[model samples]
Target: ALQHYHKPSIFNSDQGAQFTANAFTGTLKQAEVKISMDGRGRCYDNIFIERLWRSIKYELIYLKAFDDGNHLSQEVSTWFRWYNRQRPHQSLNNRTPDEIYYESCL
Candidate 1:
């Protein structure tokens, strides 16, 4: 990740001493990247990931019980493919993510 992407202007994370440690903050400081933190005990810090977990629980994970870790992994992979390539999101103007992404690439 460090090699492939340009340094971001700001990084957001929940409060953790490890993140606040000099080693970590020093790197961001050297890079001139701003660090943003969530308020303690606030639930909104991980809203997007939380929303995705909600969707997976309601739409896929709760539908059937998996016999093993491999089965669960496979099903999650399939669900992601269906999510990105097939399902239309109303917020995206009823287009699948792949459609919007690939259109821009071409």
Candidate 2:
């Protein structure tokens, strides 16, 4: 599955079971990706992901109530699109993340 998809040259995460598992490691290994793990008790090393979850909970999840898994799946997908392409971020100089990323690629 990973072989068919685009893979990053580096994958960084905490030392969680899923990341530490042989199955996951094997996939990264085969794809020649370097795995970087944060040190023990060092969540602040990745403050961006932390801020993202906080923003998602505060802006979207806390405000929405879903009746079913299907509804939730749909809404989360919608939320991701809005977050990436529509919502302006002060940190990105009021530009959307998609805009900044695409321009950087060009």
Candidate 3:
């Protein structure tokens, strides 16, 4: 799909064992994509994802007790919509994630 869309690169998750496996590394190598890993025990290495988790937990998860998977999924979707479209982020100069993402394209 990425190739079909003419996408150049992809960066991702290296914490999981699947990402560390020879098969996975070989696939990326075959595609000539750069492989970057977070430094061991360095929380700041993945600050963006960490911050996202903090925001979700504090702003949504902590505010409610979900009764089931369906309820939790609905709440999570709503939270993500607000977070991406409305919530201001300091790292983005107070712009929302969607705003920053689109701004970068220009």
Task: Report how far residue 76 has shifted in candidate 2, in Å.
Answer: 1.3
Residue 23 of model 2, lDDT score: 92
Candidate 2 structure quality by residue, lDDT tens digits, 1-106? 5667567889988888998999998888888999998887798987888788898888878899989999988988888999999999999999999999789878
Provide the global lDDT of candidate 1 against the true structure.
Answer: 0.86
lDDT of each: 0.86, 0.87, 0.82
lDDT of 3 by residue, 12-90 (tens): 6636688789987887888887788787667788888887899789988999999999999999999899889998888
Q: Comparing 2 and 3 by TM-score, which wins?
A: 2
**TM-scores of the models, in the order given:** 0.61, 0.85, 0.71
lDDT of 1 by residue, 1-106 (tens): 4457768889887677987898998888888999987888775886865677798899999999999999999999999999999999887899998999889868
lDDT of 3 at 55: 79
Backbone atom clashes (below 3 Å) for every candidate: 0, 0, 0
Clashing pairs in 3: none
Please give the distance, in angstroms, between residue 31's alpha carbon in candidate 1 and its true position after superposition: 12
Candidate 2: what lDDT? 0.87
lDDT of 3: 0.82
